[model samples]
Target chain A: MFLQQIINGLTVGGVYALIALGYTMVYGILELINFAHGEIYMIGAYLGIIFLGIFTTAGLTQYSLPLSLFLTVVLSVLFCSAYGFTVEKLAYKPLRNAPRLNPLISAIGVSIFLQNYVMLTQGATDKVFPHVLPVTTIEFSGITMTSLQIIIIVVSLLLMAGLHLFIMKTRTGKAMRAVAQDKVMASLLGIDIDRIISVTFIIGSGLAAVAGLMVAMYYGLVNYSIGYIAGIKAFTAAVLGGIGSVPGAMIGGFVLGLIESLGAGYLSSEYKDAYAFIVLILILMVKPTGLLGKSEGHKP
Target chain B: MLKLENIHTSYGHIEAVRGTNLEIRKGEIVSLIGSNGAGKSTTLMTISGILRPVKGKVIFEGREIQGLSPHKIVSMGVSQVPEGRRIFPKLTVRENLEMGAYLKGKGQRAKGKGSGVKGQEARGKGEDTSRGDSRIALAEQLDHIFNLFPVLKERQKQLGGTLSGGEQQMLAIGRALMSGPELLLLDEPSLGLAPIIVIKIFKTIRELNAGGLTILLVEQNAKAALRLAHRGYVIESGRVTREGIGKELLDDPAIKRAYLGE
Candidate 1:
């Protein structure tokens, strides 16, 4: 039972890390905590369900698993990218030159708006996600693992690896980093700061959508409320890893996952969320900038 | 090569540049010298497209660039090293230079001509959508900047934020040069630097102008700016008060008393 719970924790935590990356990346660049990002994740799952419904109605279920997953991911990415772009243009861009607090409030407003909008459209009821993958279990050393768990882990890792490479090597990736460092300077040097920022949102929201789809598959159901807890936990992971650090979010997610799992196994299962929060508090108290965050000194 | 015609710019309700006119011809260093708050920086910002003018036009290389975006102005080959050495502090010195050559490389790649490991990628992407070429051009331009500022070559891997003040100024200039612009707009290049570093920077500016780079400089240090410039403009309260040859302005009694601190 303990081993099974560990696997479960790892699977869920992997998805949380994926979602957390978007938050960390956006915050890293703009210093804007996009409260609406989790709702973007929720929307991704909803998009997947909508696509699946359309495909099933069209009788495309006979397609191979790989092709189906590819279609799901492509459609989800397109939807999420468009959604992220719209969110930025409407909610964030207008308030860009305004006071920082204005945009922060706007982000929260967007979050609430998206949540309620989904609730209104989807009737506030939990929608059951159809099983898209085989549920075969593989046992090793008295530990049982589901095929879905393996798929989630592998897919998340691959996506993370791809993201890491893109940030480190690609031209647009470099532009994003340049803008994050200094928007005015980047503009002076001929970088389109606004375009890079939009691309950042696109990448971040796309990742969130992928995480949403994976989580929906893993849990077999989703609701408008799904984004809230998952969003909080993912945010905690981001903070734990260092809010602006990409690799930090990944490490933070795994550590939080393990802590929650072990706490559930050795202590009370009801205390799992509490345990994660307690660890977060401890981490913050010890290092407010986060585990991997550097304290930047401003020149007076 | 560049002209600001009766341009008016403001910050919120406060008018910073009120009907200011300025010009910089090809192969000349034209300095705008004034006291702080006299709209010198505001004028530069307006030309750089960071601040759009409330009224008037900016003609550069015979093209009207008024109301254009900053990035678009850059694409038109007018590069500004803004006030305060706003280097991308988190990026390496090398990466900072690469950004300058973004559009040039993009153009080169669009033409489908270059030789290097990265050139193939650029050629394949083509001119209309060749991010790869722009990247390669940026790398090549970095090498040119490294040669121009050898210290930067030594500290190529160092983060822009970690550079010393003098080094940061050099990096800012070098970053702008990477774009290979026909015209360079410099805003207060000597602010907060030691006398020795300021002299070195001014000397470099003179050398760059002599090498056929048209320059429009804004400076608070009137004496130093006038010494290096061929022509000078004196602005006060957001308008041009006087314009003359650099030596004539330096010798003017009113200019000496007010700006040159006789």
Candidate 2:
């Protein structure tokens, strides 16, 4: 039972880690808590449903489930990337130089706008994601695993690894880091600051789109409001790991996932949501910088 | 190679550079000497397209580049080592140098038109192996910088923030050099360094100038700047108050009293 819970915890943690990456990366570059990022993830979920619905209606799902799923992911990622880019351009770009508080408020406004926009258009009710992925169980050493669980963990791992390599080995990634460190200096070195910020949004949103698809598949349901709870939980995960640190988000996400899952299973399933916050508060009290975060210190 | 004609730059309602005119000839080190808030950095910022002048033209190599973006200006071969040695602190020495060569890498990918690479591809770095030429060029530049400041080579793996102030300044200049700039704008390279280190930096600047690289230097150390410069301009209250050949400005009694600490 304990081992089975670990598997379940890992599956959920992988999704949280994916969503938390969007929050952490945006915050890393802009120093603003992109309150609307959760909305982007929520939008990703809706886009996945909408696209998968189209594929089903067109009879593509009858041809091959994998191909249909692939097309759906690709379309959702593209749309989510566009949404992320447009949000930065419309909502955040104009306020780049404004006082810190102004952008924070603007972000909140964007969050509300996106949530309402989805609710008004897609309706406030829970939307059913098309049932396409085959449900098969794999039992090993008294633990049962679903193919979907393996798929979720594999997809999340691939995306994170790809992101890590991109940030470490690519010129654009280095430029992003440079911009994060010092905007003016990065500009002087020929890095287009605005473009880098846009790229951040696109990447973050793309990852969220994949996570949205996985979650929809796992639970077989999604709602406009799902982004709020998931976003707050992922954000708590970000803070728990380290708000601006990429690795921190990954670690924080899994940690929160495990804590919540184990707490719900062993103690009380009624207070599953509270476990994340409880651990977050405890971690913050002990190591405010989060697990992988560097402590703020005086510059020489 | 660069000229700022009757430029006026401002921060909101308050103008910082009011009708400032300056010129730098090819292969000459022209130093702009002034006190703090006298528009020294503002003029450089304007030249680099970091600050768009409210009025007037910035002509570089006879092209009007006043309204260009900062990256556009950098691609055009004008790079600035900004004030305070603003090296990316968290980046390692090698990574910082790699960032300096960012435009060079972009320039290559942009040339392959049929590959659908936008001059600014925002998705991620492409898998194209077309970086061969730029990669070689980057290595040459890195070697040049390491040779110029051997200590940087030794500390190539260290994070930029861990470097001492003098070493950071050297890294800043090296990073700028990696951009392969024609006209380099350095703002207060001598700021917050020991005298010996300052002299060494000045020596490197003189060496670079000797190699035929044109430079526009802004300095509060008027005497050293004038001595190294081919010509000098003393800016005060947002305008060029005095202009002369290096020694001519160095020996002027008024310049001595106002800036030379008579």
Candidate 3:
């Protein structure tokens, strides 16, 4: 039974990690909590459904499941990248030098704009995702795990490893780190500050889109309003992990997921969502910068 | 060659540099000497395109470049070692130097990129020695910098924040040189350093110029700056109070009283 809870928690945690990465990367660079990022994830789920629906309509899903899923992931990732890129250029770029509150307000405004935009277009009802992924379970002793859970865990780990390598080894990644540290100095060294920012948004949004699609597939439903609650939870995960630390975000997501799942099973099932925040508050009270965050005392 | 005409810059409502004109020729170390907040640093910033002047022109190699961005100005062969050593503290010494060679890496396979960007193309005649000749080229450049400052080679794996102030300043200047800039702007390179370190930095500055680099140096240490520069300008209250050969300014009685502290 404990192992069952672990499996369930890991599936949910993987999705949160994907979304948390977006928050962590953007916050790492801009130091702004991108409230609209949740909406991008929401839109990603919608794109996934739309693309899958298109594949179904064209009879492609009937012939090849792998091809349909491939098309869906690629098209959804590309569209979400565009959305994320545009959000930064239109909403965040103009207010880059403005007072800190201005961008925060802008991000909230973008979040609301996106939520309503999706609601008006997709209607206010929950959309169904085809239950195409097999519900077949693998039994090891008393613990049974779904195929979907294994897929989500594997994919999330792969993406996380890829992101880790890109940041550590690539020249562009080093520039991103440099820009995050000191923008004026980076510019003086001939790094294009704006382009780096745009690329960051693109990568972050693409990751969030994959999470959204996976969650939609696992839950078998997606609503325009799902982003609001999921965003808050993922943000809690990011904060718990040490806001700007990527590995911290991943670990935080898993820990939060376990806490919520175990709390729901052993404690009150009604407070499943509240379990994450309660734990986050407790952890933050002890370590103000979260688990892995270093104090940015030198920031001006 | 570079020239600044009637450059007026302000931080908020307070003007930092007002109607300041200065010029530098190739292979010369021209120093701008002034007390704190007298616009010596401001003039260097305006030239490096960090601060856009409200009024006037920044002519670089016969082209007007007043409104260009800092990165664009850098790609055009002008780079600045900033007032404070703003090295990326979390990055290792090697990574910090790698960032210094960022412009050279950009120019390698993408000469077509800057063409559509208007006047801010890679017009610098400076060498892009760090481009994709594998790690060998970058290693050679790194060796040259390490030869000049051997201590850096010993601490290549150390974080930038762990370095001493003098070491940090050396890293800053070495990073700027990694870009292979034609015109280097040093802003208060001698600020708050020990006399010995200052002498060492000044010696390195002379060595760089002797090897055919042009420099516009801003310094509060008027005595050391004027001694090292070929020409010098004294900016008082955002305007040029005096300008002449370095030795002539060093010998002036008024300069000796106000700045040289003799």
Candidate scoring better on TM-score of 1 and 2 = 2
Which one wins by TM-score: 2 or 3? 3
Tens-digit lDDT track for model 1 on A43-68? 99998888876776666766666676
Tell how far residue A221 is off in model 1, in angstroms. Answer: 1.0
Report the error of model 2 at residue B95, Å.
0.9
Error of 2 at B149 (Å): 2.1
Candidate 3: regions farther than 4 A off: B108-136
What is the Å distance of residue A72 in model 1 from its true position?
Answer: 1.0
The DockQ ranking, best first, is 3, 2, 1
- Report the number of the highest-TM-score candidate: 3
What is model 3's DockQ versus the real complex?
Answer: 0.78
**Best-first order by TM-score:** 3, 2, 1
**Ten-residue segment with the worst summed lDDT in candidate 2 chain B?**
B114-123
DockQ of each: 0.62, 0.76, 0.78
lDDT rank order: 2, 3, 1
Docking band of candidate 3: medium
